[model samples]
Target: MNKKIGLWDLVFMNVSALFGIRWIAKSTASSFGLGLGAIPAWFIFAFIFFVPASLICAELASTYPRDGGLYEWVKEAYGEKSGFMVSWLNWTSKLFWYSSFLTFLMVNVAYVLGKPELAGNKIFVLVCSLVIFWVLSAISTKGMSFAKIFTNIGALGSTVPTILLIAMAFIAVIAFGYKPASTYTVSTLMPKLNMDSLVAISAVMFGLSGAETTANFVTEMDKPEVTFPKAIMISAALVAGLYVLGSIAITMIVPTDQITASEGVLVALDQVAVALGIGHWFIRIVAFGIALSVFGAIILYIASPIKMLFGSVKKGVFSDSFTKVNDHNIPVKAVYLQAIIVSAILLITTLLPSVDAIYNVLVTMTALTALFPYVLLFKSYIKLRKTRPNEKRPYEMSKNNGKAIAIANMVLIVCIIGIVCSAAPVMPSLGENIWYEVQMIGGGLIVIFAGLLIWKRFTKRTGFKESS
Candidate 1:
């Protein structure tokens, strides 16, 4: 039997999984691009959209503590086919997300190299991005032990720089008496519920999301029912605090209009460095840390989804090929297959007119893909509560079943509204149209359907036999 991870390990892993280095940079950059008012909107959405989602997950994770996480929970509640679809959508989204992170890593590398224009050079970014992706892929293929090391290192490496930068910004503000470009008024602080604001909020929500992994980690946890919910609450609180304070720090140092989607965090840090009489070398170090953070996220993107793929295969939902493993207990074939898809995405991105254009599409698509799993998970939670009322659950949200279901439903409704409204075509002249937005959502649906079709065909041909 595999050794169960202790309570502390589970907590740390859950926190690491939820709060990656890229999140800080991405959230900060998003605020700059969306406007300062957008920050509060994200806060609202996070509390309403994310908190309920976490609660739903807590109930599900405790009820169905298993290795496959979402795949197992959905399968138990719905069916194997639906579960496979959820996992497939998630795994597929990570492929494109990994490509986006690679772009982010390359952009930061250019910033550190003092060749900002190189980030826009598709060939350079693509080649360098592939190298980074493959290197991480190699490490991932060694085993989960190796991947866990990278996850811990990457989480710390990326998080320290963000916290340090936020601290430095505060010191700069106090020591130099720097004032923000805009006042911190109620109007500036609140997020508008308008179409454009809502869309931007959706993008930010994607950056903030990722608590669903708690279900996967529960089986490894020492006392999952008790410890897991505490960890989820702590992680959510910490992430919310970091995002709000980080955005304020960035706004204090740089004008919102000047924030670019790709390099916004680095740009803010650069300003802080100059203000504090810090040299270019020091700023470059921070940029390097930022790059590493994105790199770490890319590494997780490479490693996390293989388990889902393998689990689906074991359940006879996917082909036997995905179940193949190497001496190191790594899913080498799945890693390579995902890498190929990610590489293809990088190539397709190069053909796009601009990095921002490609990024917008990718970000939107990633959000849409992630949302599908949430919908299924929430539905599963409601069903399981009613159908399996007497099942042992380490953690129960409330003594009253009605209250728990109502809270879960509220969270689902808020997230659904946020996601649907954000997908509408409303962003200013970045060529965002109904067709493009529909393509993003439609593409995700197609991928999910395709997975279902493949699973049906595979099972029909094989007589639903589980492979050794």
Candidate 2:
């Protein structure tokens, strides 16, 4: 197997993973709260939150440099049990996100086909989404080469359309002397801290989240200690700039209050095309690109966690079945298993009346799943500083370990607050009762703890150990 992934390949994967179609989904959603003003805030948050987090992860990746990424870092700093929980949470979160991506893709396709009424038809969406998922899962099982091709194509397919849309919007503004939808103001730029505003802000942060996925590629790089951090910094900056400009362009054409999660960006693009007297051809192309982007993201969604699962199983956290890779060096069974779980989640969305509710629940669940790893990750960072003081780290937060820990702690606290506030009630009419929201959030927590307990018991009974 070719274990070495090149620097350019690393950039593609990181860019693919970081921006993907979800960033667009997020930028589209941001219209609900900050409108055009949210663009700069999104950029600011990315630098403030994502950059430092990436640096911390880069230090960890350099010190460890393993396939399972955060899972390995936690295990090295903590122990087997904590590592198992972290790995499981990371894996499951990816699965939840996979379903979300599939939903997004299906919804967009339905709209582009002039079947807007079918957009909320969960049965149709779920069925179509499952078909796409299985096809991508099959290609993923063929190996990383096929997967990389899709990721690269998907990355370009999605990004180029966004860049075109931004360019077109700029031309329209200059040619027609059109003003922005909302006046840019300092007060308008800052995120609101109330329940309604916090939920919207949390959605914006979701776009900036997930940098740790890039750390998983460290083992494949020739000199990961040097190259990995460079890729992360470059990728984060590029993604943040794209997000800010894209959000600004879309909101410039559409009123924020009129934006719906489902049709915001498309509506903006359609209006821009009309205003420019260019017809709907550009909008159609944009829709196709968005569809391809979501499809590509779904492909990576299946591929990434399966790779992580295979690594974790090899490390003894999961069953041997997960370690069984085909002649292509792909975990066929693991990929299918992931697809099945995602399909099940998609199927359940059909029964739920509110697709937004489903989206919110899935988003909250993803944040919850992601939080477990960050908790262990911060703990791991502290422990590694003290326990493995002699280890050569290519990068460190600071010479003072306590100061690093304090900053990491602060980031963790912010993450926790974001997660909690995400689950908090937002609007009174849209089933945003606090108690109901808590039950959903609480239920997700219960499932996570249950999974942890089950893994712990299984490990004990099976005599699983670090050396195994």
Best by TM-score: 1
lDDT of each: 0.69, 0.68
Query: Compared with the true structure, what per-residue lDDT tens digits does model 2 show for residues 277-376?
Result: 8876666667777887677666656676667655674355456687777898777777888778888777765555555556555655565566667767
**Strongest candidate by lDDT:** 1
**TM-score, every prediction:** 0.88, 0.86
Residue 367's lDDT in candidate 2:
56
Residue 19 C-alpha lDDT in model 2? 70
Model 1, position 397: C-alpha lDDT score:
72
What is the alpha-carbon lDDT of model 2 when measured against the actual structure?
0.68
Which runs of model 2 end up more than 4 angstroms from their true locations? 1-14, 21-37, 138-144, 216-234, 313-323, 326-333, 430-440, 463-468
Q: Output the lDDT of residue 326, model 2.
A: 83
Q: Give the TM-score of candidate 2.
A: 0.86
Looking at candidate 1, the ten consecutive residues that score lowest on lDDT are: 24-33
